[model samples]
Target: MRTLTGREAVREALTEEMKRDEKVFLLGEDIGVYGGAFGVTAGMIDEFGEKRVRDTPISEAAIAGAAVGASLVGMRPVAEMMFMDFITIASDQIMNQGAKIHYMFGGQLNAPFVLRMPAGAAEAGAQHTQSLEALLYHIPGLKVVMPSTPYDLKGLLKTAIRDDNPVMFIEHKKGYGEKGEVPEEEYTIPFGKADIKREGKDVTIIATSHMVYKALNAAEELEKKGVDAEVLDPRTLVPLDMESIVKSVSKTGKVVIVHEAHRRGGIGGDIAARISDSDAFYYLEKPIKRVTGPNTPVPFSPVLESEFIPNEEKIIEAVLKITD
Candidate 1:
């Protein structure tokens, strides 16, 4: 295995898939020559050229409209929105058009495209950093994936590009430069699969995207305090691996759900409800706790932004309370 940054892992997957299939192409603002706002697609335009590695206008709606049309005509277009907040500009095309095509047309058509949204709060202000994963995951026909590590990002992104329905592939802005091990050979990670980062007995910590890393750190700290914690990553929200989550809760008897997204209407509520309603309901010793972002717009101040995002301390506090 070789190590690669999350940006490199994503670029490698896109480059390999583009070379493998002629129909696969990249399109978005600053994605071609600028290499994406986060440099995830750096040096990609040279190999794929302008035709495939297109630099679209600043209009998110136009980018999504073109992607939907391309997918309808048998092209797998991967479009990126520099920030997830801009998703509102393209919501019509994504929700009304791409999402409904397969079901609206009696299964006679499919919009097999990928919308790459770079999300999560930083100093990028309120507009550039909204975790809209749960918002889009609520759509009936869309597939939502959030990969935290380079290895998982590379594999799951390749799978999204090859799938037959529209997919929302979210990349955490903070994770772009983070490095991790990825195999030299090609591999694809399946959806609805939860990866248990650590095994424990006192409590289960279910986290999404970058929060998985935070939860892992919290688990380590909890261990020193004599409270064992299990960390689980639900890779995809729509096809979430409730089986793995339920099993972990059944064993640990206590749970904490963490995410960078705001608490109101986010997937965290759904996960807690599901466990309380499942066969594993009786396994619970305490109510499931959620360490999530406050239900407010992202702050612009560096200090406030840092406090806005969920961190290891929050996870540890929640676990300690539940374990107590």
Candidate 2:
């Protein structure tokens, strides 16, 4: 097995899939000559040519509208929104049109297209940095997938492209540079499946996207303090792996849901509600703790941004609160 950066892993997935399926095409601003804003699609235009590796104008809505139309006509268009915030411009096409087509047609039609976006806060500031998974999760027909590791990145992406619905594949800006080992052979990780990054019994920590790495670090620190924390990563947000969460909480009796999204309307609230409604709720020794961003816009200053995102220390404190 060879280790690869998150960017490399995603690039490999798209490259390999495009080689295998002619319908798979890349379309977004700066994707052709510019090789994409993050260079994830670098050199792809040379291999696939300009038609497949398209470079559209800076219109997010047009990009999504084109993807929806392409998918409807039997093309698997992998549309890219340069930034996650830009996705809002295309919500009508995504939420109302692309999402409802399959159901409205009563399974007579399928939107087998993948929409990729660079998401999450790193240094890009408020407008560019947002964990918009909750918005896609709210939609009934959209499939939301976020990967924290290179392994999950390749696996879930393949699944999303092959599935029979519209998929929102979110990539964290910070995770793109991080490296991890990934298998060489082709494989797929099913949607709605959760991966337990670390198994323990004292407490369960549920996290998504970049927050999963923070929760893992917090788990290591908690272990040194004589607390065992189980870290569960729900790779898919819409079809969340609630069973894995319930099983972990059933054994640990204490749980903390951590996310980079705001505390008020974040996915952490939904995860907490799922657990509170589950039969495993009786096993809880304490209330489920939620560690997330404050109800404020992400700041541009490095210091303010640091405070805006949840970190290992904040997760550790939340775990301690639930345990003690």
Candidate 3:
């Protein structure tokens, strides 16, 4: 087992997959010599050359369109948007063309490409910071993935590249430098599977991306006060592992959904709704709670930004509400 940062694991996955498949290539602004905005693709250009690792102009629509076209013609392309906010520019291509191609073309065509973007706030201000995992998955045909750890991202990214349809690979900005154990051997995590980061019987906490770590911290603190909290990470949301979530809630009889996205219309709401609509709703001893960011733009000021995002303290409070 080798320990690597989330960013390093992404590079490793890309390098391995590129070597494994000749059709796999990368294209985006500053990805070649500049090594991507956060250096996720550093040193890849020298290995794969410009033909496979293309450095595009500052045009997301063009990057996405090129990927869609290439995938349709039997090439696996990974298109990177400098920031998650810029993904809106390529929405039409991803939604109208890439997402609908297989259905529209009578199942004769498929778009097997990945749109990778760095999301979440790190004092980058309103325009630059956003959590768009929920927004992209709103489209009918997109497969959304938000991996919280280096190991999960490496496996998920590799799997996303091999899939026969469109995938939105979301990397949280704050988690890039975080370190975790990853196997030296190549492996891929299946979609729709839930990982129980920590197990308990008092309450179940469902968290996504960066919030998973925060929830784990909260769970540890709760344990000291005679509360046993179970932390469940729904690795991918679209093909959500409702069976695991329902089982966890069924045992704990209390549950909380957590995410960095805004509370309104956010993925947290969708998760909570699913549990409530399921037979597990009768198993809950208290109403399911959601600890989420406020419905507002990411603040530029450090103080306001910290307040805008969910924290360990907030998660603890939410858990206490249900358990106490």
Residue lDDT tens for model 3, 1-324: 679999999999999999999999999999999999999999999999999999999999999999999999989999999999998899888889899999989999999999999999888999888997888778888888999999999999999999998999999988899999999997999988989999999999999999999999999999998899999999888678999999999999998999998888999888888898998899989988999989999999999999999999999999998788
Every candidate's lDDT: 0.92, 0.91, 0.92
- The C-alpha stretches of model 1 lying farther than 4 A from their native spots are none
TM-score of 3: 0.99
- Model 3, global lDDT: 0.92
Name the 10 consecutive residues with the lowest summed lDDT in model 2: 156-165
Q: How close is every model to the real structure, measured as TM-score?
A: 0.99, 0.98, 0.99
Candidate 1 residue lDDT tens string, 101-120: 99999999999999998999
Better of 2 and 3 by lDDT: 3
